[model samples]
Target: MQQQAISTEQSSPLTLSVALQVVSAIAVGAALLFVVGFAPMDVAHNAAHDARHSFAFPCH
Candidate 1:
């Protein structure tokens, strides 16, 4: 006998909300990284500068 896996179903509304939240979080994180990788002369600025200088990426 073969066993089948059971899956839990989420309502469409709940699924959409969760998906939106995940996408929003990803966007926020990307924005933060862009700032950190492009902003010059600040706290996160160091990360940006290093990413450009040591990593051979343009900071300008």
Candidate 2:
């Protein structure tokens, strides 16, 4: 019986462009949260604080 040949090509699990897109999205989201969540006004601060508590994130 003849044996089948095995392929030697190596493939990446993730492409570079996709990885960059993911990183960029995360960075933008973090920046947005930082800017809006840390506003000086009491209303904005309270809203962000309450949101953190709702998500079980420690603010203190």
Candidate 3:
């Protein structure tokens, strides 16, 4: 009979690398949403508006 070694510590599903990636992705998404979705500045809004038109997004 072969016996396997049992781990005393439990492994976490959300590791350090995964947590960092999640945070970075959230930051990037928030930045994009803020800059493009509803930009306060005119230049940013115009740029995003052009991009939306290019993508066929109807924005009045």
Candidate 4:
């Protein structure tokens, strides 16, 4: 019985298309952060607080 070897192809350098995708993600994240002035800690705190009380508390 003969075994066949698999051929592996080498990839090219990172192109402009990939770079533009990364830039778009960064730009969107920056825009979102600019609109929301709170830090991640504050965001997490608020989310946690809401999750803990949103279902049971009417006075909040």
lDDT of each: 0.59, 0.58, 0.61, 0.46
**Candidate number of the best TM-score:** 1
Q: Over 4 Å off in model 3, which ranges?
A: 1-14, 50-60
lDDT by residue for model 4 over 1-60, one digit each (tens)?
Answer: 011111112244546445655676787788764434333456644655554355443222
Question: Between the candidate structures 2 and 4, which one is better when assessed by TM-score?
Answer: 2
Per-prediction CA RMSD (Å):
9.9, 13.8, 12.2, 14.5
lDDT of 2 by residue, 1-60 (tens): 011111113234446545655676787789887755655667766778877667665454
lDDT of 3: 0.61
- Across 1-60, the per-residue lDDT of candidate 3 in tens digits comes to 011111213254546546655666787789887778666777877778977667665554
Score every model by TM-score. Answer: 0.52, 0.43, 0.49, 0.39
2 or 3, which is superior by TM-score? 3
Give the per-residue lDDT digits (tens) of candidate 1, residues 1-60. Answer: 011111124345666656766676787789876776766667766656756677665655
Among residues 3 or more apart in sequence or in different chains, the pairs in candidate 4 whose N, CA or C atoms overlap within 3 Å are none
Q: Positional deviation of 12 in candidate 2, in angstroms? A: 11
Q: lDDT of candidate 1?
A: 0.59
